[model samples]
Target chain A: MARQTHTPSTGKLPGVEKCPTGIRGLDEITDGGLPRGRPTLVCGGAGSGKTLLAMEFIVRGIRDYGEPGVFVAFEETADELSRNVSSLGFDLDKLVRRRQLAVDHIRVERSEMEETGEYDLEGLFIRLGTMIDQIGAQRIAIDTVEVLFAGLLNEAILRAELRRLLRWLKDKGVTTIITGEQGEKTLTRHGLEEYVSDCVIFLDHRIVNQIATRRLRVVKYRGSSHGTNEYPTMIDQHGLSVLPISSLGLDYGASTEHVSSGVDRLDAMLGGGGYYRGSSILVSGTAGTGKTSLAAAFIDAACRRGERCLYLVLEEAPAQIIRNMASIGFDLGRWVDKGSLRFHGVRSTLYGLEQHLVTLHKLVSEFHPPTVAVDPITNLMVVGETAEVKSTLTRMIDFLKNQGITALFTSLTEGGGPAEQTEVGVSSLMDTWLLLRNVEMGAERNRLMFILKSRGMAHSNQVREFRLSDQGIQLRDVYVGPSAVLTGAARLVQEARDKAQAVSERESMARRRRELQQEQALTRAQFEALHLKTAALDEELHTLEAEDQTRRVTAAGEQAELARAQGADGNGGLSKKGAKRPADRYARA
Target chain B: MIAKHATSDTELLEEAARKAKHQKYVLRLYVAGMTPRSREALRTVSEICREELAGRCDLEVIDLYKQPTLAHREQIVAVPTLIKKLPLPLRRFIGSMVDKEKLLVGLDLIPRTP
Candidate 1:
């Protein structure tokens, strides 16, 4: 280890005091900066960004830092390098003509020359020495020195020669770097190179599913302390820039007094309208509980209001989220196409968490989006150790805040009880907590969600039934019973019991109606029969009386027909007894 | 949108220089792939140069993709980087080769330049 020591400040007779690496945080990691006058190594494999990184280092030194430099290459010509990094906007030939920089290309080919076993690398030394002195270069980079080992077969001599060259460069009292391709398993093909060099840096390239990740790690530094974790490095037109996740400043961003959550109900539940600008809010819930849909609604709201949004999908693909939430009344795919909504999807385990955090910072910085979101932070945990993930989360949140950007993060909860979930927690960095659970009422199970707590704002505490449909997630007004938050089996049982009870009630009502009808019919029949019998008895009695009177009249008519006929005919007002005979008997019964 | 797109290589550099602020030095560099120590040396030196200078510089970079022969007239022996020209004394940082002390003394950014 290069025991990270401050520069001795020995009043040297040199033309300058110290040279700093323009890369942020690099100076601190190296204690001061690279040694003032030595060549440094930066090596990697195919398409590992070695050439680009070295050029940026030198050109930036000259142009931005006012330090002139000399750039030498054996693989590609200076013109090739220039065209490669044109997008970053660097001019090489002009600097050369102005005597501010010197770039030399040393070509080494297998077919062009034969290497003797005693080769001393004299041409490289002379060319390098000449350029260093000519430009008075403060920083130097040697990209892919592995070719030396390939061109020359004598390892013994090569190691000795390389050691001698490094010592000579060291005697020159300059910070130096030598780059070579990493071996299959070792840090570099010539594994012993680290032992020979003052500082050893390992550059890596890992390809999984065609998304490449380039990283840099300080394997060892002879006189300085460096960040130990593997850091993500990006190469664009600006060349190699390492992402320093640990140094993110959380308290340094500009935050607005007011921030709006896209939805009115969600905002109301969150105290006001979600979080302030430059703040991070985490929305955690179980599967299929509208967590993703809720986030999409927020993104849509932001885009509609002309606030820039970046939606990062770590759990699902962008297309999937768009399609799934399309039914929830979200029109974000249109915004994505219009560029107001930026979507980035990546598997969490594919790269290190630090790298993921770095990429997020890079994108946010580049786009300057007003609102940013990460769907499900759990995936980042899959990428590395728990502590690492936590730190990455902290750093990422800090970075977003420092940028004064509004950020939303969603995480997955294992169970459904809001209280139980609270017990199992992540970093409590959220300003609002929304608890969603499944509650049983009678025989029906409902999705009940509500606001548990919100900082700095008054909110409704009523548990509302959460319903999702074509219109999106809506809070229903009905309350649900507190039945252990109906899970799979309980919900099923409740539904069955409800259906069975309805069936039983219907059957009992039908049986009672049948019994009442039968009793009424029997009473009506008995009353009609009794009335007929009484009428029959009264008719019989009247008939017998009439027969007896007729018999007596017939006997008398035989003796005195004239007298009997006269008497009966005269009695027109016949007795009241006869008139009341049958009628009175029926009335009495 | 990048303004006033310059078509010719020479025109691009001229435009860059003209637009560049005195404190912000606009620079364009051409380099090839990593082959020998020269390329690596150039990579190392430029970063050191950027720091000593601070914000007074701007760099526009281009990679020749291992075809250093295009910049042959510039007498480039290193593949990584070449400072074509600058203010007064012409200087060059060869290869990806970088040394901190050498860079401070060599670039003259500290006590001398100021």
Candidate 2:
């Protein structure tokens, strides 16, 4: 479908040829533009920018397309029209002087005239035809043609003449735009839509929540298909621009490149790298959870890479943000001075949601930055509802993605709820989400960060304690105590207690080893003393054996002598018994 | 029509009426080609000028078809539009000039109240 619209030469449908209006987003939505050589009725209430649209059509046609135009104003004089649009940089007077445009103011006063016989609006035709011929115009605008109804008394003649005028313009082959005031039950006050039937566009200006938003919608197109959504329109210094809520479809290309999240540990947690180059990143946390600091870091990293970065702040001034970031060791002001970072600080309630979106679009186009950061997008919810903010963000994200720009958005999630949930409901649209949380433990609050989800990478699921110091943001592994994840003072206290317990256990093991060595040494000493005693006893026994041997010999000799007196064989037996008796006595001793 | 009683008050009123009638009036009638409405408007305006202000009125009839540029220059939006020029307070009337009374009143030939 995109290819069909972009390549008109090959895929052009058999429909009315289009004349591009040269508007920002109008041509994209209208398929091409209003049907060429046919009248388009633009009807709206006062202050709804009907006249401005018609004037811009003529001016842009003359300037951009080189097609001369004629503007027949029934309400404002030519000078008034010129002066009114000068703010938009359209020099109507100059265009007229160049002979490229012709402005004719048609004034009809009913009180100055008396009708008695039949008449036609041939005089108006001659005037218009003469002007068209004078400028060789290819386009014309008749602003508020309904004023003719009030100026002329005869309705029947006016209606018939109006019909004839439209038909004549069509026959002339000049694309025409006729404006009318809105009516109660009809598209136009005098039903001008009935006459100019080829196309019709409606402009609406409505106020919601005290903010004004202008919208444009194509009500009908006879021979073409057009976008049916009510697109938001804005009239800024440049001109009127229609902002399509979203692109025709989600066909934007996804990039494979990676861009840093500015925090090393964050990059590690996000699967060894950073987010996709053209992806949207959401940093959601409760108040005072350092959402802005994370965004600033990302912007700083982008700037350091020599890529342009746009910082859109809604909650703080640029100077204040720079100062605050400087305290965190991030010199954002240096990037700003180097012209790599641009700060666009605006109050969230400064305008409507649509206006903010338009401003963002304009800024992005003007700067053409490769990276953008919107700090605390939650503040934008103050101006619009959640759905509106979400839609606006979706469009913003889509626009950035189409340009292959990496975007970081900070959202202030209310405390006590799931930190992963973004209140604006844009978490689904983000490709990467990093959640920051504050855990209160042991009378102190400590920040913790974890990658909630990273779309296309391996990420760590461990929750790390987030710390901010004079140096910068630091992420440390949170202590998993026996019962809970300890942080802040509790983690410090637990670490100290564990170290002390280890020290005491080492000291007790050393004392037990010393006691075992002393007991073994005492037992060895006792055994050595007993061996010495046995040695001394053996010496005494040897001495005693020497003496006993002599005594036994004497006894044996006496016994033998006695035995010799009796006989030789009995003496030998007695001597042997005496020797055995002496030996036994020695063993018993 | 005037009452000729010849009283002093009547003579003063007649003198004032004569002066008002002698005032010069310049009128230009713009028409588109020779259409029926343009022809009728031309005829009615000529008769009104001849009968009412004969020598005191100056009338010029312009055809938009011949002088198409004049339609834009004169700011003419309707056919058969008569613009009273030389009068101090210039006035313009549109449509076919068949209603002679209204034309006379617009031309200041008849008192507005009457």
Please write out the lDDT profile of model 1 over residues A1-589, one tens digit for every residue.
1221233334343422335666644555555555565445666677776676667767878887887776767577778876766777887888888888887766654432322112344445656676677767665666556666665565776677677777666565545556677677876778745544555556777764444566777666554556776777766445567776555334564444656566667666656666566666666667666678768877887898888899999989999998988887887789988999999999887676656876786788788898988888877766666676676677777777667777777777776445434222444766566665655565655666676665567778776666777786676554233654343345557657767988999888888888888887888889889989999989998987786666545644453554465666543234333444544554454
True contacts kept of each: 0.01, 0.80
| Candidate 2 per-residue C-alpha lDDT over A242-294 given as tens digits, one digit per residue, 9 for 90 to 100 | 98766658888888888888888988888777888999999999988888999
A250 in model 1: Cα distance from truth in Å? 6.8
Model 1 lDDT at residue A67: 79
Question: B1-114 in candidate 1: lDDT tens per residue?
Answer: 244453466697666555432433333344544444444444554575466445665554444433333444444433343352554344444334344454444444443343
Predict model 2's lDDT versus the native: 0.86
Q: What are the C-alpha RMSDs, in order, of all predicted structures?
A: 20.8, 5.5
**The best candidate in terms of DockQ:** 2
